[model samples]
Target: MGTPTPPPSAAKIRRTSSSGGSGSIILEKYQLGRLLGRGSFAKVYLARLLDNPSAPEVAIKVIDKAATVDAAMEPRIVREVSAMRRLHHHSNILTLHEVMATKTKIYLVMELAPGGELFAKLARSRRFSESTARRYFHQLISALRFCHQNGVFHRDIKPQNLLLDQNGLLKITDFGLSALSEQKIDGLVRTACGTPAYTAPEVISRKGYDAEKADAWSCGVLLYVFLVGSLPFDDGNLSNMYRAMHRRAFEFPDFVSKSAKIVIYRLLDPNPNTRLSLDELIKLSWFKKSFSQENLRSQGSDENPTGSEFLDSKQFKFMPRVNAFDLISMSSGLDLSGLFEEETTSSKEIRFTSKMEVAEIEEKVSKAGLEFQYRVERRKGGAMRLVKGRAVVVVEIWGVAPELWLVELRLVDGAAELGESQWGELRLGIGAIMAQ
Candidate 1:
């Protein structure tokens, strides 16, 4: 048999430009660009394949191995990479192009969502109409169903992690907390991890729980947020919040349609055994209405029971895609989470822009090391570091545009002794050289 045509996504990956390059290039395949977002241990950047003008833009997630190891997050990171690689075929799931790593850093090249996070959109619009909410809900459920059938469970489900493409299609991301079937002990998952408001009560109870059922609970909470613009269960006190979740207590606004309410109610059922199964969910009257059959592909023989097309004549109404904005105060009801707190800049951090080539920046660091009696070393992933008797400084170069780069120098260790003078001299030295 002619090798069954590789999936469309697999074919695209095979056609990506081969890797080879130094300075601003990741493994010679992708050239890194402006920072898209940052977390405690990782930074996501916009990037594109080198030597291929028609290559689509992608996001490269650069994870600091040292930082993650220190925080005991190495296992979680590994699980995320494994799960995404196995589950990228679904329409609503984010696509991970490839993963590359060095001794100190791991890079995950993935499809970029130009439309940004769903959380940001909801923040701007307040809440969606019933029909609009149903559209997104249908897509999200379809993806969740696929994940369940494949034995991967996304423990965290929220608007912040649900992204949108240019056409407003929902894409699920951030699988760091996901659980695979092989990881289970005695056919059950015992880990208690997920966002407080979105976690299932069974998980919070510390008793082993069904991975798929916990994920189903989160899906319910997500749908509630999409329609109400707020969390279903939240409180200033952690105990109180968990208590509310145990009872599955939440009220729908007058605007929520009866059918939508029924769906949410079934999904939020505290008893995992009675929770709406994926097979049952799609058949629900609410989920079937106006759902675009073309958007959902049958996964197996049992997926479409009748093997007949959905007869709904109404076209799926497309919601307008909007720019993302910082989420403001969510004091609508029992809001207590500091989740949406605005980010603040620190006084010690310094940033500068330059037109110098990446190689020139490396040369400057070498000269600085000689002038200051420090050892200049090259990190496996194209980063540079200066070490003087354990006082270490890390330098990274990010390409923002052609001929323009943003270089960041951070003091990693022995800050008290090297405080201003050591790094200051190095910064001034590098800046002075760039000024030439």
Candidate 2:
């Protein structure tokens, strides 16, 4: 960890007051402190939960329904919530602690990343050394890998949307532009969204492009920006910039290492099909210098890394009932519950929606070393049972809301063998398999 980067001097951290019953100005549950940040659609404030004074302060996103000019934007807000919730608990992604909506507005309670955007930090230091850039790049890749695993793609992967916590951890924020991997037809998305400079060639082509590869291309641009303090294909003329991006026109300063340049070249490949996949990118000599194959191999083990035994005395909490839209966006990420969901009477489970065919999911699960018995339960709904020694895991995947499959996981093991560490490791394992 390095010196904590200070936030922007112009951040509007003002004290806001609301009406109270006794003519005083104070909100009900949260004490709104300052304006932490803002966007076109909403504003974020630094606030604390009234009941839990000792709890960490949060960044509350205020989205007023009346602020929008059209009724259609509400669905996009819903989509943002759905996308954020689906990515819950990812280390490199911002966490949505709570979602509260009133008739007039929706309030989202989120974890605060006080260190501000990586862009601001870059501005202060001019540019990061290769080691520093490598560290942040690793987090960016990991977060993007997790998103891709869950079938989510952050179409906008710019520095402005990337924030750093006090401890120097990078948190990927702003899901308004995120989309489910299967939302497109034949894995080709028609919309050309994202900042013009960082946009992938295929996306600019408008003929349709793979969202996953588009994300990879953005990552390439990000790494380049991090290492070199400027845009690779930047130009005053929009046509020239677009032309440069399509032709993969970018140069490395003499200071950039050969290994890093190789990774960037593969990532910025004009053809999405030839773009280096996450698995391939991670194995690069330069990138792997930061994170190695040893840790990757260790994540698949059933044992905890720590020597202590895992005591699962507390039952795990199930998520609140979700609307149909959220249920669909989360199907891929929820496969992780088999590793972490605590044991209880009423099925300890996690539910998400998946676009992958049942046959495809089943094939992946089987290849992961688990044996299962697939059963048909009513129309468009089915269940799979897997048993190991005496430990049994039940998975139910049902079709809902047009081709979407609702996936539910239940653990039936009376004796809990895995704890937080083990479960986290298991999530990495499952995520890797799903990314394939």
Candidate 3:
């Protein structure tokens, strides 16, 4: 068979010209201008790709190595870049053009979304009208369905992550927490990681939760925030917020349309199994008639329209097709098997001398499912000095017959593993294991 056709290239917009000189050398090509925003570990700068002079202006995210405290975060960053590179959808999702790295920093060149964040817009407008909410919801669901169909779970889906183009189309960005489902894992993933306010109850409870379901819950929270201008569950304490989530203690505003309310209720269901599937969500009556055909056409006709316009249009339909090995190639370079190898050589063995610190232990265990109890041990003069060593957690899920599955979570100063009885408890994490 012939090679598949590549997706259409992104539209190019004129960039501001830069003067040539020694100081202008770096600024001439990338033209890294003023800092637009700063996050915990990174800073975003307005930039231009001089190689493609006519190409639209873009934003460059510079992740400082000195600022990143977590060693485990590097793999997650790589995974996000790889996933974005593989995705070629035409939604408002921010497109990653290239990844550049240096000894001190990593740079991500992305499309510059000028319309600002959806959160800012919401804050200014207080709450969106049903008609307005429906318009945005239609676009959001379409983008999310595209993500799910491609096996991508955008773990972070708050309004802050949503961007708007000049034409007022919403674009989803910030894939720091994104992961490909095909990545190898010890059995099931039990990590309780996500923004607490929008996190699903199952995730906060440390239950084995589906990433897709967790994403759906966040979407539900987003819809609620849009219509009501507040979180469904908020409290001074994290535990209290979690409790409220478990009890389903939240009220929908009276202004919400019946159809929108129905969809939100289904999306926020505690049971992942019962939550509205992306396919079903896209087919809902409200989504079907959310925006008029004229509105969609008008958005698409803009000179530099947001990709969401195309996604919301009938021309952009998501058709599910099964291809067994598509995800396999995406994770080719990641050697997870090495992580499972047991220490055979005497030099590889390390003796534990001290009990792991409770705070450090909690951080690692927090990522695991609550069904398992993790035990940490400090190794003497291994990776680091015993006094300043790291910790590792070995997790084994329970109830699976035959061979037991194991996962190791490493932290500074010690290591921990799931208790023997906890073996086989992870469903999705174990499902990620592939045959050699």
Candidate 4:
């Protein structure tokens, strides 16, 4: 490690007083402290468990329910919960100890990694020596193998999402984009999602892509960055970058070793069919160097340790009060040729704020659909799917704040049947009902 990046300083960390009662107590348990990180809809705080002197400090991820609903990040949260719960057995995977919720917020109690994000470390160090990089890469591959063996696919794998503990052990975090085997339709995942630079070509193509192959491509990108200190396909233009990835346009620096070059080449192959699987990659000579069973076992036992007692205590129940919604707008009429087609041009989305209660909003939407002679069917998570002839629409209600709600109506399918004028009429009809 060169010129280590210091941990988040006191000046940067904001203090948040845990609401209600006195003296920064949350749910009569943990005491909130410095803010670890902040994002568009959430903030992470460092906290300590009350009355448990031996217990370690934890990171409390505080998500504003209203903000999440506004950003359509409900599905991402649900996927994270599901993925973490399933994959937390591995030592290299971040542990989600417990979950809590209030009327306005959702809390995820997670294991603390004081070293912070791996990306931050790489940024300061510029690049790692071959042995150092290989060690980290081994841990990543091991954790990823464990995930795949358990039928989980971490769709997003990058330095930013990887964390490091105080001992410098790598831990994979952020399962917001992960996909479970059960989510597969006809033995393939069709969702075209992930960081543009790291995403596989097949995924960008919108054709059904194998989850394992997509992940391998991302791993290749990460490996190149570890030794080269830069992205393989670095371009200002999104189209040019994507084109480079599709054509396997990248070269290794002269400093990269021969064995590392071979591994990277096999992994970065544009054709998914020819890409090396995680199992095959692990057996490569470069990966096998300085690697042993002892290196992996050094972290600790594989047995699941008993989790926080409070997480299981009867006094507390982890139920997410905020409803999770799928943000990805599915379009059957999408053109497969374009990798970055603008959804604004095809997807009709409308949002309005109201003082009405959730039930009142639901009723008004139903009444509006009835006026338009559209058959309304209730979908999971309180969404209404309306169909009439070949026109299809989805209406959803989200609570943004106390006494205020956001009503959203999106035209998801059959855009051809619902022309611009008809879609406008549908939106206006709903608006009229709510106005009453």
Candidate 5:
């Protein structure tokens, strides 16, 4: 088979430029610009690939490994890459281009979300019309359906994590707090994660809870916020917040349309068992009218049983639209991935499949100034670690089927946060840095 064709989105890019920080030379491939955003462990920068200006500007997340106060966060940092790689193909999910690393830092190159955070959008608009709100909610539901189908649970779902592209499309970002269904103990996620305001009652209770239900509850909170311009369950005290959520104590403003109220009530249903499913929500008169086939895709209606060439035709108005929702809410909702599901799927675990020689790989690392420490053989492939002033760089290579090879770069300490000079040199030595 020939090389796979990339999505049209891969070709869309924002503006790009470069600036000197501390009078140092910038990386050649990426012309680094201004700082975009920052958190405790990472800082995002606006960067453009020199070879492809037509391609969208990438968001480079520079992760400072040595800055981590807790050793436990290390695993979670690595897990973010695995989670994004699997979830990248969806229209509503963030896209990760590559993850490169040094001994002390890890670099994440991702899609630029020029429209900014959905929260900022909400703040600016104050509130949305019922018609406008329905459009955004339809997109959110589509994203969630995809995650649940793939067995990934975004435990955190709030406006803050939801981003909007220039087209006003929803893009789900942060995965640091998410958990895969397979990782649960006894089909129950025991940890309490997510912002308190958006968290479900069961999740904040500290008792083991269903991941699907917890996320649904959060989604409901977002809907309410989108329509009301404020959170449904806000309070100064933590105890008060939990009390309100447990009892479903919030009230709707007079302006909220009757149809919207119906969906909100069911979405915030205190009982997870009775909460509305994706099918039921789309079937509502409000959704059907505003969220027709033209406006959005249904997670539960992929087969298009009617075989109608015009799925979005208004002619179906009097033809009983119930089947459309029923189809979407099937055992598994409609899939937007279509027959191209293989294009979206990627392995989360690290494995090597490069044709490059091992000796050449070692020579590159040595030439980059990382002092070779030692190498040890494992059952399948050996491992090696290099050091330079308390910084640690780990190299893991393994053999796979049909005589394929792969190499992985892991940043340990001091070296993880590379100076502009070191990062540039290391990139040249790393042979075919592959994304798993």
Candidate 6:
């Protein structure tokens, strides 16, 4: 895999020159206009690509190094960029065109969404009807499914992250905390991350939890917010919030649909193991019904409607292509491996390989019950090294014949083989293996 480009420095902060009474211009791409908004760590600007003058305008987000207090966040930012660059989907997710870095900031040129945030709309309306909520929920689920399938988990899923284009289409944005689903850590996400109102119980407990399941809980909170103008578990005190979440105590308004309520309950299950998986959510009756309706609506006369006709249409046109040369020029030396590091041995050796294949050993041990864990390393020559540890082979004699069984095979000390046990049946699967 290629390395990510370095972020910008603090000295590179440039003010945007106001054309009229507007603010200072930060980044200047060909034909792109001016800056729009500023966040804690980044700034967004309205810009147009030079190559496609007539193309729709895009919103470029620039992450200023000066604003990033935590040096640890730099890797996370790079990971977000790399992930976004690889993702290309249509259902309301922000389209990342190109990424560039100046001396002071990392710039992400993205498709400018015109409609603003769903938070603003929800605030204005105080809440949405069941049908409207269902529509938005369906869109959110679809986008999440795409991310999940690609091994991404948007740890922050709230109304604020949901941006709407001029055509009123909702798109997911702000992937700062997003990471691959398979990511593992010793403890829960330490950073008291995410909007407090949407945070899951496990997050507050400071216990390490699955990012995917945490995301699902947040989605459930978002659903509740869309349907009822407020969070399900909100109180004046932080302790109250934790208490409510711990008890899984949240009331559904009488107006909420039974089907929608069912979905929310499943998603908000306190036990991550019992929580509705993404696959299961996609198969729910509510999702099926809502998705079918959305498809019908899209196929009907509403097809190809402009931004003015629908509040959800994309207001600005996105540039078809981004200039990689420009990006490389702006970026300095970046450490790509810093963002994605696999588990290493005691010597801290980094293995870089494309594939690993494990061959089946030739030995038939009687099989009754089997449980084993092995560490498989991908060699440079496209081969796999299965480092097994201990194997417990047991033979039980029944009324008729003796049954052989393998209890637990702990692959820790070193590679070990079962003596006359079923080595052939102990086949290993190949893939990226993290020791930790």
Best by TM-score: 2
TM-score for candidate 6, please give it.
0.64
Question: TM-scores, in order shown?
Answer: 0.63, 0.66, 0.62, 0.65, 0.64, 0.64
Specify the highest-lDDT model's number: 4
Structure candidate 1, residue pairs in collision? 20-28, 21-28
| Candidate 1 C-alpha error for residue 257, in Å | 1.1
Q: Candidates 1 and 4: which is better by TM-score?
A: 4
Which is better, 2 or 5, measured by TM-score?
2
Q: Name the runs in model 1 displaced over 4 angstroms.
A: 1-23, 295-436
Q: Write the per-residue lDDT of candidate 5 for residues 260-342, one digit (tens) a residue.
A: 78888888877777887654665667766744554553233342211121221111111100101000111221122221222
What tens-digit string does per-residue lDDT give for candidate 1 at 91-172? Answer: 5788665555544566777778889998999999999888888878777776776566445799999889999877787889
Residues 1-436 of candidate 2: C-alpha lDDT, one tens digit per residue:
1111211121222223342112222224566667777767577887765666676777778765566434446546655676675564445678776554343445666778889998999989888999999878877877777676455788899999999877777889888777764366644678777887887877867587888898998999988999989888899898888788778788999999998899889999888888987667766788867564233221233321211101111112122222222111111211112221223212234445567887886666555434123221221112254445544444545433355556555443422543444434434454567677
lDDT of 4 at 103: 51
Give the Cα-based TM-score of candidate 3 against the true structure: 0.62
Model 2 alpha-carbon miss at residue 62, Å: 0.6
Q: Name the runs in model 3 displaced over 4 angstroms.
A: 1-28, 69-72, 184-188, 292-436
C-alpha RMSD values across all candidates = 20.7, 13.5, 16.6, 15.0, 17.7, 14.2
Every candidate's lDDT: 0.66, 0.61, 0.55, 0.69, 0.58, 0.54
Model 6: lDDT of residue 55: 66
Give per-residue lDDT, candidate 6, residue 385.
31
lDDT of 1: 0.66
- Residue 274's lDDT within candidate 1 is 97
- What is the Cα-based lDDT of residue 244 in candidate 5? 84
lDDT tens digits, residue span 223-284, model 3: 88988899988898988887788777888877777888888889888788898866667667
